[model samples]
Target chain A: MNDVYIVSAGMTKFRKHNYDEDFRLMVKRAFDYALNDADITHKDMDGSVSAYFSDHIQGQLIAGAMTNDYIGLATKPSKRIEGGGATGGLAFQAGYEEIASGNMETCAVYGFESMSHLNTWKGNDVIALGSDSNFDYPLGGFYTAYYALMATRHMHEFGTTPEQMAMVSVKNHGNAMHNPFAQSPMKITVDDVLKSPMVATPLTMLDISLMSDGAACVILASEERAKSLCKNPVKIRAIGSSSDTMRLSDRPFGKVPLLPNESKDDYKNLKYPGVHSFRAGRIAAKMAYERANINDPLKEIDFAELYDSYTSAEIQAYEDLGFCKYGEGGKFIEKGYSEINNKLPVNPEGGLIASGHAIGATGIMQAVYAFWQLQHSVKKHLKNGKLQVENAKRGVIHSHAGTGAYETVSILER
Target chain B: MKNDVKGTEIYKTDPLIKRWDYSLSYTHSYAQDSEFFKALGRNVLLGSYCKQCNYKYGTYRKYCMYCGSETADIELPLKGKIHTFTTCYYSGEPFMNDVPYTLILVEFEGIDSLFMSRLINKNNTKISIGMGVMAKFKSLQKFDVNDVYFIPEL
Candidate 1:
């Protein structure tokens, strides 16, 4: 396989673009920055993959072909890929695979979403299409509604609180204040987060992610091609993807997936509180670290961008990513760990919780932030003033599609 | 838990026993101004089909999403099954009906046959997830496209 390196990445500041910003318009803006950043043009853009997991929400299925028309490369091959919230991340995976398999020397991956026009309450009803429609949808359940159940269950099982979840919002938004692109740029307090209206009981309005609209683009090129055009090339040390049951009910509750051990049967309680999220994220993390030849993530990776469509997701990632031990997540945030200037900084880009989320645009948005941070070409919102992953060298990007149903964790090295 | 439980039924009897339902919004599109709007005015359920993928889908689009082919316009079924369902007791026509009402995901039977619509139940029966449901037309005189609801199979 050829060495796939991310030469350039660009993202729109996540906000409620409504229908005011069309998917094509957003993708074009991000694409301009990406290509220029890569020292390439539309003609040299060997191939392209467009992803926007929301034709139902606010698109007319005009994403794939219309892009090349704008670039005047109307004849170049292009296609659309969808895999839930990880649509953006999945686009990157496609571009990377294309480059690695010698199918293309360089390719552009882009994702766009316009979520403001959507009825946010309907999110539960719609994402259910990818799920077991009969079993899951009929129960009056949804992604956030189900996630709320996870939060409540986690709180019941391990004493996790709405306040600890708030602390995460407090920290990430503070990080986003340094990031000019973050939609929810206001620095908030735990009190502010807790006081916010409850969208899903345990998940207050602040704990839930914003209905953001934005687009992101990343240029993936072979190692040889990137070194020639780019000042700093980020290597894809690891590219791993895995999935779990789309039916949330099918997953054993209260059970977490453990590392494959000598005694696989030694660990029997798979139905623990935070198992699915950890299993999805850890399996991705382990595959990434294995390729990077690093065992420890907290110390080895400089800056990390984990998918946090909700506050609970980040806490799950901390344990799943081995940033902390299982059942230590609440304490993880309680002690100021995982915040900027701590042992490890997560979501300096404000994450989905504050940055606003356009399902397909979210995961790629995470990767773009990690890319900018690693190159010291960091955006303003995530610079965190005190310690912003100082001259970060290696970074990890994770995008979880529809809870833990689909996961992609990639390691990027400068 | 007790206050949340113990459900009650609601009935409405008024001078106007039957009334027409309506839903409409205006968006400017030259392409839609011609044939599409004409269909919408006639209450024709419009959809699109892709020749390349040999798949049919609803909620019309300009391009074929699965195969990236230019699409041909088509129509969807008026009836379907309850793909999933929900009961809402907190809100909706409080004075006429309350306690609980079911909203179902109805899957139509046709070529790549699919669709989801709300179900209006007057029986107060148990609304299961995978229950068979069929469209209940309110007659063109009293009907509106958005107001079309499904009834239980039996």
Candidate 2:
């Protein structure tokens, strides 16, 4: 097996696009920008992968083929990948595998979502289709309601308060103030988030991510190729992917999947991975940590780009990633453990909450920001150094989909 | 030919975006779980029990998710407690007008899994976890999951 390195990455400003900006235009912009960032052109790429969550939102089927042709990679080896919100992260992993397997020397992964075309409510219906359509959707299983259920359960199981969840929105939205590519950056307070219009009980409109229209692209190359073609390339240290039952009800309780930093006794008598926690996230993070030889995440991993589709999910991730013990995530945040200036700055690029979640583009957007961070080029890509973690050497990018069905974690190092 | 093609609906004037409405219903089949929906019309909530693993599901399953064995249909208790729940102030197109509705995951007696259903008559009722609720079937059956809902136990 060969080593994979991210030579360059690019992301569009995540927001509601105007009438003229379709997905093709978004992909072209990110693709071209990525190539230019690496000081290379499309001619240097060997293959590609395209990602988008729904053909319904794009208003076109087989949209990946159109994007491949539009980006002038018409004859190159390319395919589309979709796993709901994990589409972009899956694409990034696919591109990494393409080079790691020696099937291609260089690969470009591009993802886009044009969700602005639909009304917000309608767009949510399309996303909710990712759930068990037969069982949940008919029972008014709106996505926010599903997260709300989990939030309520988290609160019951762990004494997690709505205020703790609100603090995550406050932190991520606050960080976005310095990130130009982020959509909704604000100096929000916990009170502001708590007072926002309730979409579901315990989750206000402010606690959720926006349905955005944007694109992101990352170019992965073999170590040999990256050393020659780029000034600074970040190593793809390890990638881990895992899944759980599609229906949340189908997930059975079991022993918590332990990371190197934890012990079985830590969660004794604890009903683990209930709706309050994500077992898939724990397994994925554990796999990545083992492969990357990371013993203690809180001490080793410099930062994290967590999938914060909802504020409560970020607190859930802190435990799943072993940054803190389960049921202590709320306290972890209250102590400012995840703040940008504190231990293990999370979502320095503002995460899905404040950065914008364009579904397929979201996971790759995390990668784009992580690549810039590891290269010590946040000032170069973001044009503002306010959100950059100091002396960052390693980071984790996580992407999640469904209620808890799919999770992908990839470690990146300088 | 040009005159014939000029009948497209204009969605927006500036960018020449055309209005293309994609509203259609799909005939979705429940396939193996057809019994569950049919049983709801009889006011029976059907779940699956794995004889091999001795695990029972609160929701219908053709196969045991844990042991991968064929599951036999089991009649689930209609009365259950709210394991967890959320009240929606917003929803999808189908349930959009039904905003402020409460959805719950109910835990049945002797069942290992939970079932999702709407909790009705929650207008003035304070819903909380461990609250006892009973299933109420629709008088007019839709043959969908919507046919059954829960109300606060009398």
Candidate 3:
């Protein structure tokens, strides 16, 4: 019933913090920056929502409560939201509800994750617990292997080459050079990605998103509150979330959920979402596009901050979000369609692959970058403004978790 | 009572951090899906079919995922083809020493879904999609999904 807008956005530089800053302090840093950016203090906030992925990583439970307290909102009505990697995105969605439902005029959404405490393998096992522990965990595969499985199938069915996947890493990592907050910025070629140490067949280390320690926060307000609090507010035009089977084995083949720009005939001969594609992503995009009144997302949306947890997943997302037809994602990247100056610039902030993925903060990080892009504050926020889309008006930010299990898509307008 | 608590080991000096080590062993019940694990010990793979809708789940399920009806356990064919596969050069703690292992999602004839398992590849054969793989079970069972794996059918 009410329009929601992002009044301010802020985040910590995404990289391994080496225990220099705990999750609580990291969140405070982001929250303080957000409050200052919005020109508002905690006294002006209504309610709060917090997100983080693993208690094991934090070495504490009820981290949301801890963060809320640390950020000076101890007595406020606050709730915690977690959907694995989508925790931050889902928290933003919840904060939107607070304003849209008239429950709160201005709400604060912050998310953080501290993953450096655990060793890489042990940390991976902790994340692997998000899978059906009873079924998939015993196989001893890390999340990368699961994604690698999908990558192989995508290549098999669509002739998606490892080179094309490598191109994604080159593009994203190269874009990160200008992003001051990015973790692993690089000026590399496809060969660099291909020659990187192999983590799984067809996927090298460079193809993966970094597991970092970071925090991000965004301030949300209703239309009236936004107009009064901030000079230029980025409207949360539309939001949508969808989910599928948690276990990858349980995803049943079904009709491809068509976006407004597509038809049934497009995928008539293809087996829909056969581990090669994500059904939840397609459905989430469809729901958001329909609500946002976007028919051709690739043409209409100025840019996107996709959840590129893996370079291959980014390609899959391009197709699922209808930027290109299914099976054409690899070709789409090959043509530089998602470059900073291309038809539809994606992940101009370097994405999770090039920027960093702090699990819980990942979704919120996307929102933060998108907010800055929409506000035309790229030069103000980052070292270079070359990543900014020319005359950018609207954009999409996506969050994903598990093996195509939980997904969220939100549309933001300037 | 005598004070017997020990101090936490200081992990880092610069950051002034303490090391906290903890482990949890959960005694979990498989509930309705216990038969699936139990069947693995007998060198059999047990999937389930919905009693109402007759939708088959290649992965064991006590209740139909689609119809929410009670499911009946059914033995699956031991031989299936690889729908997809990945060779992990790195993995979690349990499989750390067993790096460069292969994992496969096996698709069976007439089955609407796929089953996940490790591929032993005893003969060091090249694995590919649609390659035939046959189920093999461990004599000493752990009652875990790893109790059964697939080997190249040839």
Error of 1 at B126 (Å): 24
DockQ of every candidate: 0.03, 0.71, 0.75
Model 2 C-alpha lDDT per residue in residues A344-396, reported as the tens digit of each score: 99998789999999999999999999999899899878887888789999999
Measured with C-alpha atoms, the lDDT of residue A69 in candidate 3 is 87
Q: How does each model score on TM-score?
A: 0.71, 0.97, 0.97
DockQ of 2: 0.71
What would the per-residue lDDT of candidate 1 be over residues A1-414, giving only the tens digit for each residue? 999988888877788654444677787888887877767788777888888886666536666677657755577678888888788777888888899999998888888787754455554455655554433343343555556555655665567777898999998887777676778877789999988865555677788778778988888889888888688878888787777655443342334444432133633643442322446666776676677787667778777788887898788778777776666788888888787767778887688877778877777787787787777776442434443578688888888776677788888888
C-alpha RMSD for every candidate: 13.7, 2.4, 2.4
Alpha-carbon lDDT of model 2: 0.90
Candidate 2 residue A180 Cα shift, in angstroms, is 1.0
Off by over 4 Å in 1: A18-20, A253-278, A379-387, B1-154
Give the lDDT of residue A215 in candidate 1: 87
Native-structure RMSD, model 3 = 2.4
